[model samples]
Target: MTASTANDQRFREFKMPDVGEGLTEAEILKWYVQPGDTVTDGQVVCEVETAKAAVELPIPYDGVVHELNFGEGVTVDVGTVIISVDTDPGAGPVAPAAAPAAEAPAAPAAPEEDEEPQGRQAVLVGYGAAPSSTKRRPRRQQPGVPAQPAALQAELNGHAAPAAAPAPAAPVAAPAPAPASVASAPAAGRPLAKPPVRKLAKDLGIDLATVAPTGPEGIITREDVYAAAAPAPAPAVAVPAAVAPAPVPAVVSADRERRVPVKGVRKATAQAMVASAFTAPHVTEFITVDVTRTMKLVQELKQDPDMAGLRVNPLLLVAKAFLIAIRRHPDVNAAWDEANQEIVYKDYINLGIAAATPRGLIVPNIKDAGTKTLPQLATELAELVSTAREGKTSPAAMSGGTVTITNVGVFGVDTGTPILVCRRVLLRHPW
Candidate 1:
């Protein structure tokens, strides 16, 4: 190979690293940089979806992009080179025959064929070193259709490319005022925006027609919708005039067989539930009690100056009651270790509270909750609920729970068979 070709071979290839713990593979959802685009180190090149969550992969070298090994929607194994970058962009391509074979040993090879130099170990930090072997799944296509490029195939398959790189939301723009002649006129055309953006605008009570478009090709953007909702002066002044009220949309009947993909937190919850149901021999008991005095105390707590601005709801009392009950019957918090043929008793109470979020149900617990005073428990409980609702609960927050509490009364649910979290005792409260 010629010296120029040898220089080009110095291009760095970035592999699909393991983004999550024990993740074996990920589906390329979208590509932010196509071949020939200039890329910088630490720039997010693409987004991938694993079993647990969606994560973005960043390029690690500064260079001109050479090629993308696979197209969008392709499920790539960990350690497979996904993109190549030519470090020397100014160098021109040389004829392969013109180069001396002995001098051009590093000329080039397809990413799949490329191997690490002997004696030098290359590691991608948190991802470890690329695997010695790599494999790509065969492309799926119509019987007669010819093979297409990665991007084109991705479009045809409709595999999460659009959501890969969510367009940066623009400020919500208000709908521009209409001319006097068309003040009461129906919209001349449909507003331009992605379905998600439109849904957000609808939820925020922002009229699309009134929102100004700042996106490319006069598209309405999320930022535009948010800007309209802002108290600041809007770029477009929406005309407030009497117009026919929009007709209510009829609700469609539910499908008999509604299929929901089990993944992420939902999948984890399902697996845990199944394991707990079969592995643990549960003996449940129920007691009805008058909570009239409890409700009076909640009211009294709200009136107390010290409790002002803090959450003092029925759940708080329920949590405290469980803690007191556990304190009296410490043996209930023990776990049965079948493998060891022993019952493991706990010294501390890491009380977990079940919370429902938009994504799925999660149980984030308060650490050493049994040691905390009532006020401290209330504070921790409030924070845990808030974090769970926002989907920001960390794995650490959800681990090491000695027991769990699920408040069915919050949903007007009288009671529920609370599943154990990791073979631990779980309590259900109705009031």
Candidate 2:
């Protein structure tokens, strides 16, 4: 259906473009169009979420949307064909696809948990999308058709005119711009939020597309989102509908929680955390070093003629201090290999610092912290901070930590017991 009829009217299927500006890819959150629906170039077709934001995909061709390749929540590479548009290359092409109806059904009660996945028919990748609506909306005007509302038809062209005098000299043809098309193209329905807010949502992996728009012109503003956060225990009320339901609402608990099944990065984090917590008999000691001493060293280093532009920071000192402390407490940094039945004490300090991410807490250690110069450590620290904050930290950078010093002092309220993995014995999988 997306095929263009004119030989020269080539159909250009717009894959999900990287609208995030130099960002890599996005998750295909949902598609608005299916086969047989009309679409116009520049119309929004699907919604995608990246590591940094959620965005709407504008259809690139004026045609029938032939297929939707990806379903909700399946992340596809940028430039991937999530939808194909069919069109006639001629000046007057077919009308664009109509807007989709609400994706949710009107059910008062939640369905049983185990059955939800089995009931939903996923798109190509089997990524789950919101439930489909059984009902359809009324048809709207199509391309090459009038955009005028149906009610205005009684006073339309020629109905009130006299047919005499050669039909009144066949009223002189006047030129006017064609009416604007209705977007309704299988809408991914991301409420409008500007690029920066979108970026924030993407960074948080928040689905702005479904959040209620409280801003003017039905846009989802950043403030709206912040309010939506904070108290996260509540499942959002189903999006408002035209035929409003008349039931009294129940106030649910304000607990921030979601029971995600153990898998992927989370599963790995759990195993690693548990291992680090119990295996090593974690004896976390805290000494709030008036990091004043380290802070003074940083200032001195910054002013040094040789260290100009080295971008000195307190973390550099912490790394140095950790290495210094390691000389005395090398025992704190060793790992036990259960299978080999050996105590693995690493001589080289692969000093690892841990940070929190949208995925989970990740501990990426500095490679050979013992060998790098002050400048090198500063550079590595900057690179690591930037990459980890951007959620692009590599896995290899995370493993094989001899010992680690976590800067909880940076959190302002310092001093706490830290847990290290306890390896009960060489035989029991490093509990």
Candidate 3:
């Protein structure tokens, strides 16, 4: 129920919501707003990916963005504040202390009567936006030194030392080594740098311990890391005629290979596939059916007046046949409830269509395939496939599927035994 800053009632924080039911975390895919951007209520500020699908999160209140807590591709837990907004930008900028005060655990608590109602606010995703109860642990403070503002710290680390903080006068004879030692050994212990700067140094294959620090209080900056990573110029001096140049060593370069961190939809898909493969019994049965008649029917349906704007293909007829088969054999459309130690039979089928997308393989389903006409089915299928391909499928669209149909022929693959989606029956159609 605690706000970011009780004194600044204009500032409001938006936490990462559980976009999917029981989803604990989501990776930020993209940010649509930056600090100082004016945003209206119901404006989409960012996109995130959970285990099931990609979701766009809209800001619930109108305001100017004050700050973004995490960068893209960073996984954040539910109930964590992701963005802060200044609802009353006309009131002028708040003091720098407001930012750090949000993180300070020892700040004076507001009276319980003054607190805003902690009821859930309406949002596009999840049940609603629940107020974030998560708090930062208090940081230990030195006796006399005051806590530094984040902006001031960033400014100090980004520029040269101020003229007011001149170095103490040393003997003229020792001036040369003083500059060298100060540049190379800025700190007596481990190298000092922000998390982002350290990550940059690591990605560039630069050793922070060897790179010179240029920021205040021995902090290493991004520029220093790049400087260390840059290749040194070759010496211009020519070798003597009597001396042979030393043979160059055969050193391997890091550029020969690339490493990509697995996260987001791809990461979730991998985890799910692994779990389904090892935990469930995989039965791969192949039946080579004569699809010549079905293909002819697809061509005939393409010219039908009712199906003019609808997608008519072999997959459509195959999916319709599969639904009919499920209707006859309802026992095939059921899931084992492990917790309840029972088989949960479903009367209505949420038919999942597995589509290979740039993000990964996503199986978004039609809500009730059993109750739709052929044209209705085709329309929904086209919309679902297009949405999945565009990486815009919602989590709800991908959940509660009783059966799935995957068309491997689209990828030029004859056939494949795809792992079951959530232990449901899967049918793979070959070319």
Candidate 4:
């Protein structure tokens, strides 16, 4: 349903733009607009989570949305057309065929058919559809038929298939008597177990009729299947004179280990670390200073009316000290531009504070930290920590950092070699 150049000249395809530094793709996390929805220039149509951060993409031109090319959770490549917007507002009702049939549902007839096209039937994506409850139709089991193929049975059993044997002359053995605790299964009725419990019972080779149900309304549960599969304890009269051995832990073997695709923040962090490690010549320098007075100052500031309701910690003083050092030696606050063969001396300090969140190590900087007072800096630091923790730190917060200060002390490390964050001078502090 994506707008093709051959389809209509008025239908402009909006390509997925790179929202971060050299990010090649992003996962469409959520869509805010749908087909036939009226959108204006600069209106946010969708939110995409890239390798670096989550960004809301805005449509550049005012138009009626035609179709979205990809579904949510789809990692679309940069420069790929994700959505098509029809510039003509007077265009007729978007044909159900215009959108993917799987996504757009048929509209019910009503007096206001004109209104239905705009509000109901025109949604061209599954994400926009209202939730519908579904029930599974009962599968009838056939007699004298194996549930699985013979090849699959051999593979699951971990053995080669044997040659077919002659039919038994008589009944081999009588069926085991139904236990008093076990309930009898209803005639021609499916087992009263949930899908997961049924799967567990199948894997354990336990029959539902052999398991006594403890769950409400005679429904078989996972615990019931496990109890039925478990070996019964020996009676005192049946036991040998020797002591009973302890139960051994079962060993589990898997055919294959689960593999999670490396993408998003984790992937970006890996690439950045590798590039920085190879390209930047890292120099490690350690300095031990007496922070006895600094600790006392932080305590004093906490009680001060100026620092009321602000996070007054040793990190605040440490950040301020780094800023003063940068001011003392202004030349170090510069970057070597390899492409231009020039040193770019920056006048302002965009201090980067390294934060470890659930996503990855993100260095969101305080813009113009040098211009802020102690209270202002503390406030900014508190906000930055909160934003990073919520995974809502913007790309702008991570960009334009001239110097980075990583407090490894928070991680209980005394000292560590911090990787250069994209050519910036890194300062690591271990408590």
Candidate 5:
């Protein structure tokens, strides 16, 4: 044998190490490496899906994956072992089993409280760490503190989340807004200030709607909210509730094997849904949202001339609400930062809407949606659904979706925890 080939030890390989940011499992969103691809340690080798967003995962060691336990879109619980790297076992001492660095994450921000669709927070290693043991943790309750609503907690984290104000939201359409809308405040079109600015407005009781938008395209961003609300304004008196939520209905269907047509969008929806549901571990929690203002706003938008002839449904409000909430709660717009073995928060929103098309159930995101108005959202939803129905939607439109709303109501069903689609959605716009 030649001297180079004599050292067969150079072909030594390794299994996928648990990224160890408390990740118990992960969904293979996309592979950055394969059996044939050579990669160095700490290189962004793949994108993994967690409960909240798609995260780029890095190879912890230098090598190639000789084997993978599951294919793309498969959920892998932490420590279960995946991907054997084929490289020199003596590769300068592969540091397996070393915990993630503490300095890597001091905790990224969380999503809007509502953006948490299905609950589990820490399913994949490097997203939210799983509980140490399967045995349930004892419930510790303190006196005088009202019990947190189940909706306030992440199903994955198994811990109650903090409370959040309800903000109206809707889906955006098209590629990201022009760069002008991503940065500073402008009298015309700018991204406006960041989410922090909006929170300041909320705390000070400033109405974003009334602020003369100085942002790009005259959009009001978080910074404008702050500038408008710097002086604590008086709270607007909340209108009395004129309606209440209907009772929850039983999910058990009386008819089994009912002939639901297998035509068009249903087929596509079925395939994607099945892939997402069975492959990813799901933990969903529901909340009976009381969006009285949302209903009121719909009424107001109807009378406004500028919003004439637009589709304004409760779903639109939900989208808008998500955006508003994200301004104050951006954690929802994030994903597992697996390469860093941590959760990475995003500042933007790629709003997703689930459409039941003649081709199947499809979800297309409205990119850079964090800055649109209600009228714009309504128009986007209209176009999104129309595109899905015609099967004219591009793959790009179907990808990069952040959070999603199934709109089960269209099918005469209430909200349901949707299964992960090739895993799950993205960003800090969680709800």
Candidate 6:
């Protein structure tokens, strides 16, 4: 075969796999391997942030990196082609693939018009099931109204709109257009503001239609909503000569404020916390305990050869005591099944240790923690903390916990009412 033909046959596309259970998308945090780099089977090529955690994805086969389909920080849907590789680069000089007329991220080939769409495609990792479809549902337009293009709709909705068509290669050399006069009001229809901004305006009892949009493409921003909500300045009265005008305070510029978009582990944590707060009835009981003997025992364990190199901290002792209490009272280590209207008691304990990391708060559990010895627990705890701190904790490590313990004393806080995880009891330890 010719070099071009051989290269075409050797190219393999790698799709984004579902790293977390039932997760539909993930943001590309970092790419470890760039185009033209070599890769081996099971070699980590990139790191992605899912709703559950930050996970490293490994390539499934050995190859020379052909292309990177998406850039970092882009949130791509599962099953989209993320990278391509030339498995047999030694065959000959690889021919550059022709770019399509439409400029967009690489995606899986669509089925023929006559061919029926298949179910979920096989994923890159472990041959798991990928998403059945990545196409979005069509938006409903009002009667007698013409349908707007996707990019225009996105712009109207106060989102960063994508280009409607590919731009010219030398577009930057083109002459700039004159700036248009700002509109006093939005065009006829719903006011253009993001969902969060709309919520804020509603909460502040302000009408969005009355708020002048200072954002690009006539989109309303939070500042616009706030300005609209501000009470009208009192009509100034004719002041007497003796009455001195009040000094004006220094005005802080809005540019100083920073807004971070909620996503990934932090977003998931917030949703889970809100759901937990409303769904579960929480009751906290505080008690004083003398831990002088416990501290001495911890020190003694640190000196023991069996516990050498193992973490022997007060938290370990607290976890041991909590496990023992659960052993005595098994009813406390159970979850309520609201659907079945029953209390499901667990036969084994998966003890979760809540650790706060740079990404967010994650509760990774040690499987069958109740059955492990003190030394084993210490070893696992140390490894867990290390893994979590490095942002390498897998989704499996954070799931299926029967009970959880969070050490509030680590932050020097006396106590806190921690929300329950997975509807299981959470014990907060404080020094």
The residue-by-residue lDDT of candidate 5 on 280-321, one tens digit each, is 567677666677887898888888898899877677777887
Residue pairs whose backbone atoms clash in candidate 6 = none
What are the C-alpha RMSDs, in order, of all predicted structures?
29.1, 29.0, 21.4, 21.4, 36.6, 21.9
lDDT of 3 by residue, 1-431 (tens): 23435435888989999988789999998999999999999999999998778899999989899999999989999999999998988876564442343554575554355353444344564455433543334565543454565556547445444445545664444223323334455446589899999999989988889988889767889989989998999888977877977789786777577788887778878998998888788888887788788888988999999999898987788888888988999988988777787888999999988888888888888998999999999999999989998899998998888888887776677777788876665544544
Candidate that would win on lDDT: 6
Report, for every candidate in turn, its global Cα lDDT versus the true structure. 0.77, 0.62, 0.81, 0.80, 0.62, 0.85
Give TM per candidate.
Answer: 0.49, 0.41, 0.63, 0.57, 0.36, 0.62
Residues 1-431, candidate 4: write the lDDT tens digits: 44443346677889999887776899898999988799999999999888777778899988888889999989999999999998876755443334445766678555442233334455565446432332224455444433565566666555577666655555445455544344554444565899999999999999887777888767888889999999899765755647868779775555456677877777888999998889889999887888899989988998999999999988899889889888999888888687887888899999988889887888889999889899899999999999989888888887889888888877677788888886665554635
User: Mind giving the per-residue lDDT tens digits that candidate 1 earns over 1-431?
Assistant: 66555855767889988776666777787899999999998999998766444567789898889989999978889999999998778867633545445664685544444555455566666465554453335665544444465566567555534434545655655556544342233346777789999999999999999988888767889999999988876588665566756779877668445777666667777887899889887767788889899999999999888787888988888888888888898998887787898889998889988888876788778988888877888889989988777655655676678888887776776766777776675555554
Please identify model 3 stretches exceeding 4 Å from their true place. 1-8, 93-253, 426-431
**lDDT of the structure predicted as candidate 2:** 0.62
Q: Alpha carbon lDDT of residue 228, candidate 3?
A: 94
lDDT value, candidate 4, whole model? 0.80
Ranking by TM-score: 3, 6, 4, 1, 2, 5
Off by over 4 Å in 2: 1-264, 288-291, 327-331, 421-431
C-alpha root-mean-square deviation, candidate 5? 36.6
